[model samples]
Target: MNNLTTEPDMHTALWSLVRNNNKLFSQKRNLEKFRTLLNIISENGTIEDLINIMSIFLYGNNAQKELIENTCLPCLRKLPCEDLPKLDERLRSSISYAGWNINETTDWKQKPSLFELCILACHPNGYTRERAVTALANHYEPVALAIALIRCNDWVSPIRISARDTAVNIIARINTDELMKVWIVFDRVSHGQRHGDISLSKTLFPLLRERIPSNELHLQLESGNSRTRRYAAEVMWHTHQSLNYSDLQALCACSDPYVCFRTMRDILPRLDQRVRTKLLDLVKTKKWAPARLERLRLLMTDQPECMHDELLDALCDRSASVRNFARFHLKEHSDVDMELHYQRKLESPNISTRIAALAGLTEIGSPIVADHAKRWLKEENPRIVAAGLSALPAEVIDNCEDHILKKVTNHSLQISKAAYIALCNSPPLSAKITPYFQRDDLSERQSIYFANLLLLQSRWEAVAHAISFCRHNSKEVNKCGVFWLQRWVYGERKFWMTPSKSDLQDIHRELELSHSNMTEALMKEIRFLLDSYQ
Candidate 1:
């Protein structure tokens, strides 16, 4: 009976009882061992263990009924409600184990235990579940009722009918608190796979309205676990329950983002003037971006006069969605020149604000944005320079090519990477990048970028670039050269005109000079291609 045992020992003990189930059921001493093992399993076993036990119990013969009812049912009831969905999901996905199927008896005179009925309700066999539904009609524990509610969506019609009736009867008799405890299970199952015509909203909402007071519902919204809080909020909203300013404010401040968003989308617009002002103050302090974005949108729609200041502040907001929302509204609703506004923001000391402004001005395509970008590229701060490089347009890239090329060798990899991406499309700058590979100070990434730039050039120049890269010190860069050479010699011959014999000989000679760096496989492929040309 000691619950503290290793998992392998406990697993062996449980399966031993399952293997000798008949002897365990028929003998008195073995029944004691069965009860003890069930105790250890109920305490220390996992979801899979409990599920295996349930499968055994469901397929038990009449001789095993006493042990199953007296010992197994009570232990199974010890399973927490949270584990039921996991049990249900596992049962749904797997077929019943053939080893557990000792008898197929479905007929019984007396009603089974509530926990027993609950397990049977989830039986993978449809008929077994249907029998459990009928047996469940007389038992109404909260967990039992929740399982019955779940089965109302059973793909089998008779089971769904029996379960819906059982759920309706139990919902009537159960108090609000008891019903609330099972709400998470009921809500989960309602949305899960269902083929029946039963609508949970139509069945449960009326009962919720009759039994659940507004204060209790709000308490659920404020303090329940995530699933319960979502269900409670949804119940209150759909039932058209009126929430006081305090309740609305609490909802807006709820740590759950979806609840906060629903409050803004569904509840905020209908508030009275006094409550609206209070809610607005609370919403302004909320840091979640989706809630803030919805609040800004509502302000634009419901209170246009206050939006000018709100939208301007939002332009500096951390979220791109909020910033873009502000930009669109500012352009549509006000005479304030967005270009001038963003221009002023570009000079702000805050790095994030300056980045946002740079992005905005770039989107506006203002001619002065290039001037600001040129100046920003010269700044000592890498962030501003990186932002400037990202916002620099195609027209201005040629103008700033020298500044960008300098950053390609910058000590900060962030600025260097941004500079490389900006220069990637400028074919004119490719020739200037070749000398950078020879510099010993270049980082690993910078060396790779210089090597990869060869792939963007014409065929003969690319050959020269590959030869130059193979002579670099980094093996990774050398691999990039070998990879391109392999592809050019073996893969690209059909795609382009074959190089002249002298050009091929030149490639062969250069590769031979750098052959110490080439792998044996690469040398063989290059030799074959060059011999063909000869």
Candidate 2:
């Protein structure tokens, strides 16, 4: 065995053992041999040999196995651009087997192979450039940070956007005032353009405080795109020692719901009752988009009574997102006024308002509310009726079983599809609904949806059936089946035994002929895992 191990041909030695014995190399012993081979390669193996060995291990038995940290990773990191393409291919192959743990590779940031990623990003070929950008972002190498920053200004907008987002994330981790200034400048330039994102801008502001001059800052904040100006007001509300009369007037009168929400949240704690009352008035009258109003509602949760009048008013906001917040906050108290507000929406002229009202009623968890929904199911508009049924609780679910099953079997595809989703969600839906799988009336997308729902509940027998339904020739079904299967496989790997060789053979056979998007996705994952070992 020692003589065989010393042979120049690493693959030949491993193959001999695999072919000759049932268990000559268990995972533990195989791991040790892998480490030794890695060391030998790091010292003397050619790149061609390395790529070959790595590719073979990928998408095979070694996919789940861990790589031994030999000096090769650090050495490979220092390899030149000419050597990067080979290494990139090998890395993709070995992803399954490679330990992504950053600490393992010594001086990993200083590696030249990492720089090769930058070259790939700026590669002449468009597809190669896109792939390189993705590969670089995913690599998580700290040394690539500076290069990524430069690429943010890339001539191509798409590449620049990717690079900018990557740089923002990397900068976020540094958590220093200096980095914040850089982000603030970049954000200003990109504001109202394609790259402006509110969440990222708000985050950079607080960090910029001590680094940027206050006088210069206030001017920048008061101007710019609507989103930027709103965030600026939020910054002033947080950092201003004493709100100047002008600042107070602006903060009080700002029309953006986010600006108002942030002001209320930040200043309410520090202001006198007189000021808080003034701010509450601003919240009530300001026409806000639904999402921002939701934030204000959540903020009011600690003292709902203080702003009850305003929150109740928001329940009628034209935006469903805002109404969602209203229902959520209002339900926490469950007062008569809030329930009355919901009841009115149920009869409102707008279809979305009716949908929001049903969801709101469900959130309240009242039997009276559930009963109301059941009555609405008899209405002519099937869509509204379907939504009403969807909002019903489990106990209510049992009572409506007959009606729901009938709808599932309805000739109208929309009605059937909606019924299928609702029934699958309801606990009373077991075995009774299982027969629906055999119904040829069901669309492939509908079947795929059910398959995923079953997988989520860990109903393996049901999941197995669902997997078979993946035969629906739709790309959507194939994509969904493959995703759920991969998730199922990952979960099984954690708690279950390693898959048998026969199982791998079965998957490989299917891989060759299957047209499912999932098939390709699964193959990629399997290959990534196998490559990790290399």
TM-score of each: 0.69, 0.41
lDDT by residue for model 2 over 238-311, one digit each (tens)?
Answer: 56664654565566556555665566556665666555555555555555664246346544754656667656
Clashes of each: 0, 14
Candidate 2 least-lDDT 10 residues: 60-69
Could you tell me the lDDT of residue 27 within candidate 2?
65
How much lDDT does candidate 1 score? 0.73
lDDT of each: 0.73, 0.54
RMSD of 2: 19.2
Give the root-mean-square deviation of each candidate in angstroms. Answer: 6.3, 19.2
**Candidate closest to the true structure, highest lDDT:** 1
